[model samples]
Target: MSRITLELAKKMIENAEKEANQIGVPMVICVVDEGGNFIACHRMDDAFLVSVDIAQNKAWTAAAMKMSTADLARVAGPGQELYGINTTNNGRIVVFGGGIPLRKIGQIAGAVGVSGGSVEQDVQVAQAAVKIFEDFE
Candidate 1:
């Protein structure tokens, strides 16, 4: 299975943190490998404690599914396709905007997830990390 290096994980987290700081929110950021194994998690000062698990779950869900959680939210909505998916994966799937898969060398490398901000802010933070990962490649 593909994996993310600690260096890359740090870069992703740094970018996510930068976005969170720009948005004026303390965030919990997580990076998970392609197999949904945790690589790193960073909880900023004053970040909501509840967001720690949420961030990790978001990263795991994104890497495992190879899709953004925001996209999942569409299909996983009540009465929609993939409904109850969140309940099936040991309750790990995060059907929201904070999760984004990280692709490297044309394959899934991992994912980054951010929390402690609004959904839009979370998406923005994750996107920043995605861009950094792409540039790192």
Candidate 2:
């Protein structure tokens, strides 16, 4: 898999921030590489401190699982075997709506996540950032 470059991470963060700002929603954005390592992060001034950790967890879940956090939530049904995966990663695998996989040439390159707002708002911000990669030729 291709590595997520600093430039790409920066762009994703910037776009996510812009989207959150446009909607008047404060947010913390995080990007994680394929190995679930942090690539970059941004927290809006009014964003909650806890949002940083939440965003990172969302991104880690996406990167490590190679799927959107929304999908993970579906598979991690109550009492399902995979449900434990959500907590197995040291509480760093959040199966929520604010995370999305970053793809390059149809392969997962990394993940982007957003927090500090409602799940819908956070998902919107994260999706805006993921669009950068999705739309890339």
Q: Would you estimate the TM-scores of all the predictions?
A: 0.94, 0.91
Encode model 2's per-residue lDDT on 17-75: one tens digit a residue: 88999999999999988778888999899899999999998998888888988888888
Measured with C-alpha atoms, the lDDT of residue 21 in candidate 1 is 91
Q: Tell me how far the alpha carbon of residue 71 in candidate 2 is from the true structure, in angstroms, after superposition.
A: 0.9
Candidate 1 on 4-41: residue-level lDDT in tens? 78888898889889888988999999998888888899
How accurate locally, in lDDT, is each candidate?
0.89, 0.86
Model 2 clashing residue pairs (backbone): none
37: Cα error in model 2, Å = 1.2
TM-score of 2: 0.91
Q: Model 1: C-alpha RMSD to truth?
A: 1.5
Quote the lDDT for 125 in model 1: 89
Error of 2 at 15 (Å): 1.1
Runs of candidate 1 with Cα error greater than 4 angstroms are: 1-3
